[model samples]
Target: MPDPRTHLVGPAAEAEIRRLTRRSLLVGGVATAVGAGALAALRYGPDEAGIPWFLRRVLEGNERLARATFSNRLAPEFPRARAAIPRVNGRYGMAETTDSASWTITLVRPDRHDAVLTLPALYGLPRSEMITELKCVEGWSEVVAWGGVRFSDFAAKFGPAPGQFDYVALATPDGGYYVGLDAASALHPQTLLCDTLNGEPLPAEHGGPLRLVIPVKYGVKNIKQIGRIEFTRKRPADYWAERGYDWYLGL
Candidate 1:
């Protein structure tokens, strides 16, 4: 008998094989084109212009929405018994050794005047405490009791009128880490120039002497070991934002 393979390949079978082959090639080309398009999107989707134009636009839009709907909404407060110490995530801006007693927060007013403020001065302000959750960008949060003066009060008394400045820039003593905030958020009632945590003086690793506790923003904006604060008309540079993170990381 003739080989079954050879016997099966009649005229009609050859025609069918050609049709299937063409169909397969067409399908494959379409798939390849789709894959190439996806890769290109991943490679070039990010805005490459000087300021991440696309992302900045998106961020600005989000910011506008947030501001338009903004309220004096306060973060929920917990009982002191529910408060827990937060983990020390990073020491990017903290000094190995800090002199809490000698540490002073330097305020750069919008009018170019500089003022040195001490811990005593801060304590003398209308002191406030709130038991709120300190949420981290790394996906963990802890409720802690924070004691300090409201940032709004601080700015009104020592710095410029809250509305005069468009941005607030905070930096560590060594300038290792920094964050920028819009004037509204910086002057929010919940924003605090924190000094104590969990009913005790803030520990060194946890931004002792002074730190920012802003419930309106992610933990990154809660800068530690805050040494310098500037009220500016221009948006100040941010450490994470420069590395492609969203500049307006509102909660």
Candidate 2:
């Protein structure tokens, strides 16, 4: 099978590139007329170059707002049909090999206290219900039935109230991939530190030991192979955002 990370970037990047190309062309035409007697390149000027960048960010901002305003609605799935879900994509913060038995989740509190929660600890929490749309940045989506502990419960087990923190950052075991979530999305009614997908344990390739199920944001924000969850006031670094993607690819 092809690498899953490839699937995540192509469509979104292509669409943005095309949008930018058009603006570049239009701006080049205008620049040629203004600097006709001069020798500036016919490529996009600063004004034209700004179009796609601004639009892409604007698109990202729109997604964030939509998610924030989104009602905690569930996505419906069939009672009997089973879909062979795709293998996990993207592997920042995840190792090529992982051992779940040895995995641990760390909760960093505002008071500088640290609490460690294991996989079993998560399952021990009251299993919350969620059936939400997992919108991929690739533009496809699936409504999945997820059963796991509420992020709020996960935090409460350690320290600090759910709503007290400004941000929640999660990373894969390898620490190569990471994502941050705002307080509202972290504590959203539909957010879950999910262990089960489609009523079964998540496969090792699909963030096995633990993964986040955040309904308010796109799938990229639902960092898989979750190794740790830390509460902080600082904006967390995201793997995809550094690659020219939107930092806030919500909804």
Candidate 3:
């Protein structure tokens, strides 16, 4: 035999291998410890609205970023030819098949008296229309033509109630579903109290008769079958926000 250990590692090579293995184990142990600590911190951190405190801070930071860059330039309008009917994705307050005749919107402001207005009254303010994309938080969107009065116009005619810092809360008549909007967004010219979709009367399945069409925010904020509206200086409770979703989810 040329050498019995020819195929084997020499003593020096084996020593080097041991050293490398030990170094790798040491590095891996440190990494595992750091990773476990991080996981523990995330799990043990204080909770805000069911979100970890650090994560809520991140959400707050994103909200501030969105506000700092806020602009009136919204998504481009799609032509009527391109408008498509959006899929009905939610049914929180639309379960009841109430007659359209009974539909009324209750408007409230901190200082102003609450006013309940009929659909015809809203139409009386000023008829407006637009074709825009209704983007949902679930990563789907549709180009739909909308008809109603611009929320800005409605607010101007109602009582000019909202301020920059105020919030606008909207809900179905049953209050089973609700969403809050920053006054700035509620006053956007594109926001509308929609009654028609794709040139047809809104369907009940889609929160027909009267719904909110806020093109700037995700569809979650575009409440359907709005039965109540309130303008308040205090931030109102939001449905998705309470469930740990981004509250200020803007497009």
Winning candidate number (lDDT): 1
* Per-model TM-score on C-alpha atoms: 0.81, 0.70, 0.84
Ranking by lDDT: 1, 3, 2
| Tens-digit per-residue lDDT, 1-251, candidate 3 | 58544455779678777887999999999999999999789878777888887898889899989988888886789778999989988798775565678788888877767899887777568788899988989998899999988888887777544453378899998899999988878888899988888889988887788889998899999998889988778888899999888888887
**Which sections of candidate 2 miss by over 4 Å?**
1-70, 75-84, 129-131
In candidate 2, position 152 carries an lDDT of 72
**What are the lDDT figures for the candidates, one per model?**
0.86, 0.71, 0.84
Q: What is the lDDT of residue 82 in candidate 1?
A: 92
Better of 1 and 3 by TM-score: 3
- Report model 3's TM-score to 2 decimal places: 0.84
Evaluated at residue 231, the lDDT of candidate 2 is: 86
Ordered by TM-score, highest first, the candidates read: 3, 1, 2
* Each model's Cα RMSD: 7.4, 15.5, 6.1
Write the residue-wise lDDT of candidate 2 on 148-194 in tens digits.
Answer: 88887777776576456778888876687889877767876678887
